[model samples]
Target: MFHVGFVCAEYRRRDGDGDDELVGGSGLSRSPSRSRMIKRLESLNTVISSIWWVFGFYWIVVGGQPLLQDAPRLYWLTVVFLAFDVFFVIFCIGMAFVVFLALFCCIPILAIAYAVASTEGASEDTIRSLPKYRYRPATVLSTFNNLGMEEVLGARSGLGNNGSSGELFLHSEDSECCICLSSYVDGAELYTLPCNHHFHCSCISKWLLINATCPLCKFNILKGDTLV
Candidate 1:
């Protein structure tokens, strides 16, 4: 009978599963058995372990991660912006360096050119080179004939020994060739610049081959002449 009573009490505890409702008498709850309590604690730990993880045994503070594969949206956005900022800063620095290098290289060369132009004169200065053109009939010819006029300056001046033509021919003949300091021989071919400045065919031809500017007015011959 004593063994039977002990078996009955043990059976009641097993049925309880450490739950309050199974406790006998007056319906009051009882503290669970130590073994039951331990099992319950272990089950709770198992569920938590699946959701949260701790890593790094050697570190002072272990890092606990809630999710391994998926990060927070805000966190990844922050990382992307930080990466872009780094590239932008590097590009700005490179551009600034290029600008500084350009200025440093150009200033002295410009200063030297200015000095040469001032001291030696426009003709002697080589740095700002005048664009030289091969003499073509279009650029060096006069407006007196079709070779010169080509309909552009036909009304302004005419062919003949009268009016503007007379004065111009007379003046051109009396004046010396500015480039070579030579006299114009009668019936010799003369090339006239758009500036209406005339020179010997040989002198002006060679001059155009060397420099495209009119020797008297410094007008660029390649640019259409501003007939005076």
Candidate 2:
């Protein structure tokens, strides 16, 4: 009996020791993985910070050198670009604030407006039933008229010699319309802007209607026009 009791005690002690070792092993395994993840996060942060520093240094050198060299036009051009950037950022912030107010305070504003309109004998139903605003086709035509499209087109036509093969031969073989990515095809109608850059008639016409500039080079097509 004494021998059997001693054997049982030894078995229980061994089991307790085994359980403690298993718990310790698990903790040890998890600690290494946790430390590795932390190290990875720290490395990523360092890389991002380094990239920003390089970008800032580059811009400072590029933007500051013109001023140091006494080039007033380039300096002022950079300053104007920065000023426009500031205005653009402010405009974006203002737009976001307006959208937030519209989303949250819309019901209150609409209610107040409706109450005032109703007092002035305008019915709520009539206000709700009003048609949504849309841009007119004449707006595009008016913009073209303002840009003096006729004079610009006539000048462009006179500059480039008409190719008899229906394919416009560009001076450079590397020439490709930046818009469509395709090389000017044989039998395709093309228009050469004053900048000497050529594009398909349909592509340049659509683009010029929106903005009057060479797409490849941003030379203003209306720069020489006194009426523009």
Candidate 3:
């Protein structure tokens, strides 16, 4: 009797297996687990692709223009900025990009600033929130004392009027690139800000993207104003 029961059980197992196959073949039994896994993989790929795209752009920018160059300070600063720029581009898209980009850009600006601040004679300066003023194109050329604008002039401070601001004057057509503080000969390329402050084109471009303020007086360039 026991032997017979075992044979019957075996037959039942085979029959159950066949029925399950038939049901699957007829599409009555859906493989929900496989479907879910495929969808999850696709979503993950999309996220990864977005991140890759952002970093690619960020690296191109960093490689094109390094902050410190041969200076020891440049290495760590570069790492910080690269990480920040990549993270900014990845998570921040659309209007949010502007905010993250501004923050990432500050990494370099502050790095330069801190270097200057740490120097023996340079005064300590902190960037408070910039005040908003009306945009006046005329102020771009005028001096800081003029009404069209106030503050935000020159490359370095203490070198402008009394030669005590960040502003540096160039007598040699190639004397010094105000932006990077490197010597430039004629046709080296420079950008003259509304404040009559000159800098390397790339340097000023980086500055404008971050603050739209003059490195000298904190003038709001986006407001159609200058530091001069």
Candidate 4:
């Protein structure tokens, strides 16, 4: 047994010495392939993160303050967005559909419709029109899922902004749930608005089945609601 162990130890030492000699001769203290791979991965991550941040910031800024004063800046930002979209499309073919969206297919159509609807006064038209777009709604999926708008806005909900999970937030305590006849508990389950009302999640889920509106205010839950 001692002889066998001795032979194995000598074999390991010989192998270690050969590795050290090869490394020293090549002057490669670490594996070249690993270093190259890490550098390539880091470069790719930087590009993707930059794309995400630039567009994300533009979306926040313009969407928050949509005014003629910033229109030119917004236009250039849109160009950057388009360029990023092109790169994204190359890498993610599924995202190529966003090109059509960038073309103003849906938003422009809605904008024109809204413009014609309230063309009586331009200032009033601008106020209404701006709000129509300034807010992006939180997406809700399944209708059966009882999660709140915060979850969707936080991007925890898998549904995209334009998808079914769209709704606005309510910031009034005057709103009451008829089922409970009480003011909402902070972080309480609430119904979405323009139909600004509150309800327990369980109560609202059951209520929606029979009637998709707030019982106290008769505000519609399934439609015309904005998520804050």
TM-score of each: 0.29, 0.26, 0.24, 0.22
lDDT of each: 0.51, 0.55, 0.51, 0.49
Residue 82 error for model 3, in Å? 62
Q: Residues 1-228, candidate 1, lDDT per residue (tens digit)?
A: 333544565566656654545553433334255446555655676666434322222121222143222555644564465567568889999999988887888787897787544332223333112222212232234535664454544433343212222113323534567889986554544556667677665677667666666788876655554323
**What is the per-residue lDDT of model 3 for residues 34-146, given as tens digits with 9 covering 90 to 100?**
44554566567668767975776566567744534555475566567668966776776755877777778977799879755432221112111121111212322454453
lDDT of 2 by residue, 36-142 (tens): 65456656766876686567556756778756478878666766766776698899999999999987799788987875543232233322222211111223443
Q: What value of lDDT does candidate 2 attain over all alpha carbons?
A: 0.55
Q: Output the lDDT of residue 220, model 1.
A: 64
Candidate 2, superposed: residue stretches over 4 Å from native? 1-167, 225-228
Query: lDDT for model 1, on a 0 to 1 scale?
Result: 0.51
The alpha-carbon deviation from the true structure for residue 174 of candidate 4, after best TM-score superposition, in angstroms, is 1.8
lDDT of 4 by residue, 28-127 (tens): 4544554555456666767877788677767756674553357768756766776777677686765656766756697888877875542322222222
Minimum summed lDDT over a 10-residue window in model 1 is located at: 55-64
Clashing pairs in 2: none
TM-score of candidate 1 to 2 decimals: 0.29
